[model samples]
Each structure stands twice: as C-alpha cells, then as structure tokens.
Target: MTASDDEKKMLRASLQSMTGALESVKMSKANTKPRVCLYEVIATARDGLLRRTKLSSDIRKEEGHRRDLNHAVKDANVNVKCKQQLAFNNQDPAQQDAIANDVENAKEEVITKQLEADAQKERVSSLYLERDDFNNALSRMLDATSIVMPFVNLGEIDDDMLQVGITAQSTFMQFCEDWERR
Candidate 1:
C-alpha cells in the first residue's frame, strides 16, 4: 500500500509546521539554539558528541600520538572540551577547501549516523511508551549515553539540555542493540 495524496499532503503540512516551530526556536535564542534546538534530541546529541570526538581525535592524531596511553586518553578528553567550545568558526560558510572537505564530510557522517541513531531512539521511545521492553529502554539509553557522554561537563551544560542529551543517548543505544545492527 502507498500513501494517498491526502496523506502526502498531511505529511507535508506536518513537516511545514515543525519547520516553522524550528524557525521560532532558532530565532528565539542564539547560543541556546546550539543546545536545545532539536526534537529528536538523542540523535542530535549522538551527532554532537561524534562531531566533537572525531574532530578532537583527528586533530590529536595529526599533532602526533600521545607519549603514553594515559596521556592519550587525557588528550582525547581535552580535545572534546576544545571542540565543544569551538563553534563553526570560519567566517564564510560558503567557502570550500581541502580541510573544509574533511569537516564537511564529518558533518555529513554525523547526519547519516544521527539518522541511524534516530531510528534507534524511535524504537526505544516506542518501547518506553508500550512498557513492553521493560528496562530495555533504560539500559540501552544508559549504555549509549555513556559511549558519548560519560560524566564531566565538556563545556557549558544546562540541566535541561543535559537531561535531553541523556534521554537521547539512551534511546539511540536501545535501538542500536534491539535492531542488532552496529
């Protein structure tokens, strides 16, 4: 079966409404936008952490391997902090270059990963709603959240934003495990 034209129209209308709401949210705040500007937050957070970690790791690797494993871990932690503070800096958003390509690719990957992450989150959210999966959602959420955000503030963590991030992480993890896909 396929969606009827009415259903298609309704879907488009729903999307438009959400987009409008997003615009409102974006315009209402600046830095805050970076934090709470997501409905599918678990996926959003996974992408953010992935973005922070990947960038940090790449930079550290280029700077030269850490002297010891402990130092490497420390360096990795610091790098994530640095990335959290580092906003999309380059003035011209339109500008493109070799390094830009890497960042662009990373951003793209974040999208793909988040899509996977979101699918996972949706599964957990459904489980939580139905109460069928029992503690499955909670466990999945915790494991996934830990993978991205262990403890310690990367930078500025608002309570609400942090909570959302936690929920999102758990949801994503639950789905990943449930689907039996990496």
Candidate 2:
C-alpha cells in the first residue's frame, strides 16, 4: 500500500521540520567559552613534584658526602703535620727520611680528599639549581592555567563541574581546529 504523492510530500516536509528543530536545539546547547585541560595540568604538576623530590634527596646525599670528604681532608692534614713534627724530633737519618715520605703521602691524601669535596659541592650546587628550575616551571604552569584559587582545592570540586570543564575543553579544541582549517 504505497502512499499518494501528496501524502508522501507532507510526510517528508514534517520530517525535515523536526530535523531542523533538533539541529537548532543542539546548536543552542553548544559551549561558548574555552576550558582548561585540567587533567593534563595536574599530571604535569605531579611529575614535576616527583622530580623535585628526587632532586632534593640527591642534594642531601651529596652534601653529606661532601661533608665527609671535608672531614677526611682535615684528618689527612693533621696526619701530615704530626709526621712533620715526628721527623723534626728524630735524629736518625733513615727514620727521618721515612717520616718525610709519610708526611708527603699524607699531604697527597689531603689534596685528593679536598678535590673530591669540591666536586661534591659543585654537584650539590647544580642540584639546587635544577630543583629551583623545577619549582619555577611548576609555578609558571599554575599561573598560566589560572589555577591559583588559594582556598579552593581540586578535590572539593563536584563531578558536574569537572564534566562541564572537560566538555568545554573538547569543544574549544574542535573550534580551534575548525578555525585553522579555514
């Protein structure tokens, strides 16, 4: 039982009208403003914090090692002085020569330990600079994202706000892509 031509045309007109109405409603519901990629920003912050923590630990260990090396240098210097005093008191040529050799070896040890301490100090300084950089980078990211609501915490945000933010972000990205295509 096929419909008459007039009836088919009316049905087609009705369907087209309904489709237009639906399209209008969908367009009305579209987001107008852009959203921030909150998830990505959080991930970046977390990574930076982890790296900063590791760098802090490294700095502490390096500083401790440097202090130990400094103490070793001091002890070596004292040993050299003691050997020199002993050589000064001894009259025997052979004993004096042996003490002189001991003093020279102790002096060499002091120099080696001092060099190691200096290197460790340099490493600690570098780590401090690296950690500072990470801190500055994290601060810049937060500033750029406008996430600096001092009293507001991310965990306190409701699920609906998060969903809306994500949707807005997606819409904003699409808009950018579309604009670029032109």
Candidate 3:
C-alpha cells in the first residue's frame, strides 16, 4: 500500500506538469496567430510601397511627355499663324499659294500634336486612378497594422524565426505525444 501511494503521487505530479505545459503551448499558439497576421500586413505594405514608387516614376515621365507635346502644339499653332500672315502680305499669287500650303501643313501638325497631348492626358488620368488605389490600400493596411501592433510584439517575428518557432512547437508536441504513448 505504501509503494502504491508513492507511485500514484508521482503519476499525478507528472500529469499536472504535462497539463501545464500543454496550456503554455496553447497560449503560445494564440500569441503566434496575431504575430503572423501582423507580419503579413507588413509584407503587403512593403510590396505596396515598391509598387507606388514605380507608379510615381511612370506618372512623372508621362506628365513630362504631355508637357512636351502641349508645347509642340502651341509652337505649331504659332507657326500656322506666321505662315498665314506671310501669305496675306505677299503680292505673288504663286508664292502666296505655297505659303498657304505651308500654313495648312502647320495646321495639320498642330492637330496631330493636340491629339497626342490628349492621349497623354488620358494616360495620366488613368495612372492617377491607379496611384489612388494603391494609396487607399496602403492606408487601410496601415490602419490594420496600427490596430494589431499593440497586441503583437514583432521583435522576434522574422520569417525564419517564425517558421523555426512553429516547427519547434510541432516537434515538441509530437515528442510529448510519443512519450505519453510510451
């Protein structure tokens, strides 16, 4: 009876320890869930920042192109006016006809440049919409990160560290299961 009592006490103590350890593991898993979510939010923000950078560069280039085309249109219009004035002043019908032809060509160039500028304006408008979309997404992500940041400590939550921790937890649980079976 004395030996049996000692064995029972030892078994109860071991069982209590295992239960405590399991509870600790459950808490760790709960904590890890928020950490993983925060990490994903951060990763998405980084990707969005990169995309925004590229988009900003593209917008700047397109805006520059639009400006140049608009300037060309203005210059072409001025050229048409000058050719028309020359045609009016010239007394020679043949020379006036040639100048008139030049004036018409200059008008056509203005039309072409204006069309190009319009296309670029449309492109810039579309790019602005795309940029706005990214900004909105990033803003929402920032809001989420702020909300969860207080709850989750990201100090040791790097990708490799996170994976290793999860793996270790799984392995430890497996070991516990095997020991229990034994």
Which candidate achieves the best lDDT against the true structure? 3
List the global CA lDDT of all models: 0.51, 0.67, 0.74
lDDT of 1 by residue, 1-182 (tens): 99999999999999999999998776556435434433345454555456445545554553342223334445455554444334345455555354466555556555555555555555545534433342444445545455434322253445565665556655655664664442
- Residue pairs with colliding backbones in model 1 are 42-168, 141-170
Per-residue CA lDDT of model 2 for 45-104, tens digit only, reads: 566567668778888988898899889988998998898999999999999888889989
Error of 2 at 176 (Å): 27
Return the number of clashes found in candidate 2: 0
Error of 1 at 80 (Å): 11
Q: How close to the true structure is residue 16 of candidate 1, measured as C-alpha lDDT?
A: 100
Q: Over all chains combined, what TM-score does candidate 3 have?
A: 0.68
Poorly placed runs, candidate 1 (over 4 Å): 1-96, 132-182
Give the local distance difference test score of model 1. Answer: 0.51
User: Which of candidates 2 and 3 reaches a greater lDDT?
Assistant: 3
Displacement of the residue 67 alpha carbon in candidate 1, Å:
30
What's the distance in Å from true for residue 85, model 1? 11
Candidate 1 residue 21 C-alpha distance from true site, Å: 80
List, residue by residue over 13-82, the lDDT tens digit for candidate 3.
9999999999999878866775765566566567667767988999999999999999999999999999
